[model samples]
Target: MRLMDSSEAITIKDVRSARRRLEGSARVTPLLEDPHLNAIAGRRVLVKAECLQRTGAFKFRGAWSALTALGEGARERGVITYSSGNHAQGIAHAAEELGIPATIVMPDDAPALKLANTRGYGAEVVLYDRAGGQSREEIGNRLAEARGLTPVLPYDEPLVIAGQGTAGLEIAGQARAMGVTKAEVLVCCGGGGLSAGMAVALAAEAPGLRVRTVEPAGFDDTARSLAAGERLGNEPGASSICDAILTPMPGELTFPILSRLAGPGLAVTDDEVLRTMGLAFQRLKLVTEPGGAVALAAALFHGAELADGPVVALISGGNVDTAMFRRALDMLDAAEPGAA
Candidate 1:
């Protein structure tokens, strides 16, 4: 599919329309505050709890927007997509609600909870082996063609980006309500969909706000791309514990907006992510998957380098497996000198 020019692709108007479309379906998640987080950052910290969103991630907003925009004929043909987990569940859930058939191409080793949740949403699950050199995009595309199904791209399309932008609208409004006029907004970056979409929305709704993309250390493709002023891909052997945000590169449709409006990208280590996850549980009383906690991690660990006043971190998902959550807590304990 051809990528749309950022200038004409999606706008704040589109995001508003998506918000209207999702009025009854998508919950307007709360913007949470914690004094401990603020003390750590030495500034006010507001967390956008998108982990409470339907399907346990923010991906549902885009999936619903894209699926709902399809014409009757297209919806009848069904839809196909590829996601590590969140987007898979998002599309599957949306498809089920709209009475459309859905198929998801997912990694074979994706977190067991996410895998089970995706299937629980009633979508056919097609698994690909990451270690065996399998490509999800190729598989999804081939299946789409063979089955006459429409492909719902995870982050590369205008509609999807606009849908994701709705979250930014909420953040802007919520921050304003909390008397924050100027702040730095940190969004978890996978293929740059959420970050790029928020960039566009914030540019229009809250011009005083600055946006930053957060990623895992080794998979900072969006960070490198933003610095180089061109799209860049991660190394072939790149890997991270934050599997939910591990895309090869920034999306073609998302990079332009991010390049124009987003501030510098921030990267955090796996250990930092684990610590942040533990912190969320202990302090915020929230369950955040590792990828979802990267922005919070950046806020806690790298806030000094970010803007002043207030920092808004997007907790993008909460679909972590039980074993993974236990391991993260274990890592946090091991890092504490006096911990058992």
Candidate 2:
């Protein structure tokens, strides 16, 4: 396939194609309405529960989309990728279903459940130290070259971004079914694939909808990059409990689309994320990881600044370690009355 210009790489047509590719393979995760969340935001709040998606996250949609787009020869040659957790599981699961060999290079500190699930999905796992000055992309690429395998990036590629856009299509349709004409969407921002892809889909399908990328406080590179009108990187040593969305920089391909279509970004602290996760479990009856709940955090805490109409928050994943989940619950328990 001939490569399109970066700006045009992931178009509405591509997203629509991805939706068709994902028709039976990917679940149309529910758009949940939470009275408690609505009460908190003081407006209608719809939650896209991608946590309940296959492989426990929306990454599966993009993974399947990218893999299906590859030629048969490439599929036989295998695929490799680097991810903190959710993307790893997505790729692994897709590869397994396609009878393709898959390998994932994951951070040593990735959530235990995500690591286990990625391996359980039949991918070879290679753990790398995030603090050891080792580059995950370099390692994954080197491995791909050695094994003659295709390199599937966690974000940045057009196929993957288009695949992620499938979720946006569902959101638009579901919102319309719920009688929502205009709304702002809050998506967890990592390297911008999901946010950028959703922007494209919503632009075509729900022109009245606005998109905002949400990130952890210390690692809000996408947020800052949008404000600076250029790509930017986060501090190398910056850390957060929201490990799933801890990408160091905005993706080169995804940023341009996001810059053109997305609204100002928003961020929330780790404490807020944990509290939101706890609230999701208690109120929404949904298990949400810190990273997945950041968008919800922004909605609950910064909704007024983000939008005035109905707000849709994307809960991107739910791959939290048991201990960490318990800690989040503990934090909720210890909070001041009515804090959660």
Candidate 3:
């Protein structure tokens, strides 16, 4: 699983191939702009609304890419993976659509909506205790071995990275259509799958658009690893409301791609994430989970750290529970002094 260099890893060619596979499956979500968001950032702000993606997240592209890439024999044999929420639902829905048996290992603390949706998509769900030192990888691996399930790793797999890159292809074309030639593309990074994939795509399709990884404050492993010029893991037991992007470290394959093509990473606080989530619904009428809002949070609050140009922020997912959405909406007053 070693990607020693960028050349050996996923490339633009791989991303293009993935786009072909995803032609009728994955949605090319919208690239949106609002004057209110621009006024808040004091610059042009474009939002890649991946929350509108199927299963309420962009993970579907990767799920379809990985599952379909497997031979028919393997697909009939079933597949397994681990995720907090978004990836779980994505894999589940894609599996259901393809009529493949799928199993997902999710933390017990995952959002209620995500857990329900994953199961509703007809996959068997296994719950693990994330805060109690239980390893989802170990659980998934054991289950996979016992059930003869082919493993579809959430981010580390090359096919998954390539599939996520299709979004980058769309972003390049959409931004260009909007007359944005150069800008920073902010991505909410968990294990660097989406950001790395997008970097690969943008490097070839839109060289002027650069990617910047965004993470919740305490879980900013990707940002720290980029700064250190090597892989770095988050502190043990570090926690945040942004559960979707909380990974122990970056993926082995994705880090090299990110290090090569991505700009410096960024981190945002849970408060900022909540505010962004609130503002997204209020202004753009888009529901965003905390983890999914980190990129948008950086776009609005960390503008000083961004390059001088239009900012493209990816709202990575939107599978939030009612209570969490209410909590985010409650923060609207603090997010803007006079907003209702």
TM-score of each candidate structure, all chains considered together: 0.96, 0.96, 0.96
Q: How well is each residue in 117-223 modelled by candidate 1, as lDDT tens digits?
A: 99998999999998798999899889988998888889987778888999999988999999986999999999988888888899999998889999999899999
Q: List where candidate 1 sits over 4 angstroms from the true fold.
A: 1-8, 335-340
Question: lDDT scores for all predictions?
Answer: 0.89, 0.90, 0.90
Query: What count of clashes does model 3 give?
Result: 0
Q: List the residue pairs that clash in candidate 1.
A: none
Per-residue lDDT of candidate 3, residues 1-340 (tens digit): 1112334668789899999999998998999999999998999999999999998899999999988887788788899999999999999999999999999999999888889999999999999998888999999889888988888888888888899999999999999999998999999999999999999999999999999999988888899999999999999766798888889999988999899999899999988888899899999999989999999999999989998989999997888888888888888865446653
Worst 10 residues of 3 by lDDT: 1-10
Worst 10 residues of 1 by lDDT: 1-10
**How many clashing residue pairs, candidate 2?**
0
The per-residue C-alpha lDDT of model 2 at residue 176 equals 96
**Candidate 3 stretches greater than 4 Å from native:** 1-8, 334-340
Query: What is the alpha-carbon lDDT for the whole of candidate 3?
Result: 0.90
Better of 1 and 2 by TM-score: 2
- Among residues 3 or more apart in sequence or in different chains, the pairs in candidate 3 whose N, CA or C atoms overlap within 3 Å are none
